[model samples]
Target: MAFLTNVNPALAAYLNEADPTLWSRVYCPGDRYNIKTSNIAESINSMLMKAKGYTITYLIEFITKKLGRWYWKRREDALSLITTFSRGVEFLLALREHYADMMTVERIDGWRFYARGGQRDCLVDLEAKSCSCGVFDVEKMPCSHAIKAVKSSGWHMSTVVEAYYRKDYVYASYAATIIPNVEHDPIGPNIRCIPPIPKQKPGRQKKYRWLTWLELSRKNGSKPRKSHKQYMLVQNADSLDILNLIV
Candidate 1:
């Protein structure tokens, strides 16, 4: 039960006849608050976790390449229009609005991804930063539900980001890899000696006196009776046949 304000004139005008719940559901705090749906994003995280050991190198490079292709396409489209006809900034700027594309993913209830209303559920009460599933944790960019939560809570995205992840934490991993310079002797570094290897012992130790005598007896004897179950398990028919056929 949260209050809905006509925050934006454009949005308020568009929702003139829409369900107040629909608006809430479509946005945050409300969407995350909804007790009724499944959080689908959890499955994606599970899959990712199962696939485990994913290096950040692959993740960062792959996303950058994808975004780069998108930038190139946008630049190409802009250039194509510019070459097609004479246009000024006023016309170009107006056309820019039409040229831009918006992409969105609608959420499903009862899925792995969780939240409240149609908006992203921010459990400020629980310090959920984003969702429990970590989509917010990795992307840093909030999803629709998160955006909705921030707006409804009257908070800024920066605040939400700060609450969950520190500004310094983003480069924390990279910083660990940085090696600082330490003054060193210019001469070839003195080497440390390896610990001496232990001397090898005799093939048979006194502890196996009976075994040693038995082996000697068998070697001296004309033939020896053998009954070993464990060794037999490793002896296949082909191996047995070879012994019989060749021996």
Candidate 2:
């Protein structure tokens, strides 16, 4: 909040107004897997950069084709997997087990245990499927502490992991087909498409993006040094004299 206040007062006010659970991974319930960015949307936008400047009809067609190809390929791959859980979940569980190996577990009761890993100590309850680390509840997966407790009690990891990460569930998630609209709006009475109205603003539109304080700082720190000769050549290049310019 202090950081936002110093940089952007509006952003600080907006953050204060919005629920913390939406932004903070620790407070956010469900299988977030610790993601905290719009990189996935950004990646898709980058992939469709060319289509962005196209007409709406062409853009829709481009996206439709891309999605259709992606769905079919993923559907085939999902059907081929015979594992009990998805590969990603299995990998995570394996990693948790590796970390859990170093942790010491003490049984408290039938389903409760105290797990100590390095400087951290977490209460693990198998019956309630929870951990003091808050990872189990947030990720809907057994944390390293929970894994240590579960293994010490002679229980299989599968028994503790969420069923949502099962192979069948993962397969079912991508089973839906993306059906394309074969035809546009019917010409006469059924015309549903509307043309966009041209509304140009008075001033020159902004081409550069507004960077946050953190982004600006990162840019400054990681910025590459430019060649002085190249920079001078580009700056001094004559716009009208085309023939004399270096090819």
**Segments of candidate 1 deviating more than 4 angstroms:** 1-144, 152-154, 163-166, 172-193, 197-247
Indicate the residue-level lDDT of 136 in model 1. 52
Residues 33-86, candidate 2: write the lDDT tens digits: 655479888989997986765566767777887898888987787788877788
* RMSD to truth, every model: 20.1, 14.4
After superposing all C-alphas onto the true structure, candidate 1 shows an RMSD in angstroms of 20.1
- Candidate 1, 1-247: lDDT as tens digits: 2123345666565666666555554343322432433555665455445223444444434444454555565445444552222233224323422322121223442222323543334332213555543445434435444544444445554554432233233223223232222353222213322366998797965554456555766878844456546534436888888777865
TM-scores of the candidates are: 0.23, 0.61
Q: Which ten-residue region of model 1 has the weakest summed lDDT? A: 96-105
lDDT of each: 0.42, 0.80
